[model samples]
Target: MQGENTSVERGIFIVLEGTDRSGKTLQSHNIYEYLTAKGRKCVKINFPDRSTSLGKTLDGYLKKSIKLAPEVSHLLFTANRWELHDYIKTNLQNGVDVVCDRYSFSGIAYSSGAIKLDFEWCKSREEGLISPDVVIFLDVNLGLSSGRSGFGGEIYENIQDQSNVYKAYQKFTNYSFWHSVNASQDPNVSL
Candidate 1:
C-alpha cells in the first residue's frame, strides 16, 4: 500500500450538447448505461430541467406561451443550471459520474446563434460553474435532424435558427475539452 493513495476518486462531469433532435438525450442515456454496466456509479441529467419555477418559466418560453427578452431568456437558462450546481457537485464528490444531456453550451449557442446575443456575454454568465470534464458536441446535419420526429415543435426548431446555433457550436470546437462526433450516423454506432 506504500505509494497507493487512500483518497476516493472524484467522478467526472460529461456533457452531451447539440442542436435539438441531434440525439443528446439518447447519447446521454447511452453513456450513463455504459458506465453503470461497468460498475461505475452514473446518473443522467438535462438542462432547462422544466421542474422548478424558473424551469417552468423557461418551459413556457420554449413553448412560445411566454415571452422574454433574449438576454433574460438566456440568463434564465443559465440560472436553471446554477440552481442545480450544488446537487451536481455533491453527486460528483460522492463518486457519481454525471452525463448531462445539455448544459451551458446549448444556452450560449442558442441565444448567440439564434438571437444574435453576444457570445462572450452569454458565456460569461456561466463562469464559476462546475466545468464539464468533456463536452461531446454531437455534430449532425441539420437537414437530417429536421426530419426527426418532433423536430419543429419548439421555438428554435426551425432550420434557420438551428443553422445559426450549429454555427455557434463550432466556436467551441477548438477548446481542449471539446469532442465532436458525427451524430448523423446511427445512434448504435459507438461513440
Candidate 2:
C-alpha cells in the first residue's frame, strides 16, 4: 500500500512582460508575495539578472556608459536567461511555481524593435527555450510610460523604442494563452 501511494504536483510558469516603466517588477513581486501568502511554493526571477556575468554586461549596456552593438547586446540578454535555464527547470520539477519579470518575449520585442530585425530572426535566438505556461503582458501607452519615475537611466529607455516594442507585443497577442492587462489603469483593477 505504501508503494502505491504516489502523487506529483504540477508547477505553473508565469511570465510578466512589458516595456520599461510599465511596472513589471512591482507586479511580479506582488504576485510572488500573494502566492507565498497562500502557502504556494514560488520563486521570482528577472531577465538580465544583474547577478550573473551576462547580466552584468547587460546592466552596463543599459546604463549607456558602455556601448555594445545592438546584435551583441541582444545576444547577451538571451545568454543571461540561458544561464538560468537549469535552475528554472529544477525548480519547476520540484513543484515550485516560477514567476518571471521578463523572458523570451522581452528579448524578441526589444531586440527586434532596436535592430529592425524581423520578428522570426529575433525569435530564432531563443529557439528551444522553455515557454511559460502563462504570459501576462502589461500594456501602457508610451507617453505615459515615459513620464514614470526612473525612466531615463537605461540606454533603451525611451518613448520611441518603447512604442515599437509595444507594437511588437501586439503581434504576439494573437496567441490564446497570452493575457494583456491595461497597466495604465489602477493597479488594483488591472490585476
Candidate 3:
C-alpha cells in the first residue's frame, strides 16, 4: 500500500464564518483576490444568497418582512445551501476553489442559538453536507464589534443575539479545520 498512487483534485472549499460584520465578506473577497492573483479559478458566494426563491424568503425573514416558524426557517436555510451543493461540487471537481462567506455552521449557530431551537437539531440540518477544507472563524470583541458602524438594525443585530451566535460558533472549533482569527486587530493585520 505504500506506493499506491491516487489522483486527488486541487480545488479547495473554504468557509469564512463569524457573527454579523465580523469581516467575513471582506475576508472572502480577499481570499478570492489572492486566488485570482495566483491564477486559480475561484468563486465567492454568500449564504442566504437572496437570489433564489428560498434565499428570497430567508432574506425576508432576516429583514423581519416575513415570519416563519423556527423549524421552517432553519430548513429553508439548509435548503439554500443544498441548492448550491451540486454547483460547489462541480467547481471543486473542475479544480476551481470556492470561498464562502457563510455556510451550514452559520445556519445552525444563528438560527438555533439566537432562538430556543435545540443545538443538536440545528447541527443535524447540516449533516451530510460538503465539509470545508478550511473554516476561518473571525472572532471579534463583542463590545468593540457592536460599536462598529450600522448596529441594531436587523432582526438578529442585537448584542444578545450576537453573543449567542458567538457562543454557538465555539461549539465546532474542536474540529481541526477551524481557524480563529481575532478581528479586533487592525484591518491590515487581520487580512
Q: Give the top-scoring candidate (lDDT).
A: 1
Model 2 clashing residue pairs (backbone) = none
Whichever of 1 and 2 has more lDDT, that candidate is 1
Q: Native-vs-model 1 lDDT?
A: 0.93
- Compared to the true structure, candidate 2 yields what TM-score? 0.94
Mark the regions of model 2 whose C-alpha exceeds 4 Å error after superposition. Answer: 187-190
Question: Candidate 3 deviates by what RMSD?
Answer: 3.3
lDDT preference between candidates 2 and 3, better one: 3
Candidate 1 vs 2: which has more TM-score: 1
Residue runs of model 1 more than 4 Å from their true location after superposition: 1-6, 188-190
The true-versus-predicted C-alpha distance at residue 114 of model 2, in Å, is 2.3
Candidate ordering by lDDT (highest first): 1, 3, 2
Candidate 1 local lDDT, residue 123: 96
Please give the CA lDDT of all the candidate structures: 0.93, 0.86, 0.89
Q: Which lDDT tens digits does candidate 1 get at residues 34-114?
A: 999999998889998999999999999998999999999998999999999999998899889999999999999999999
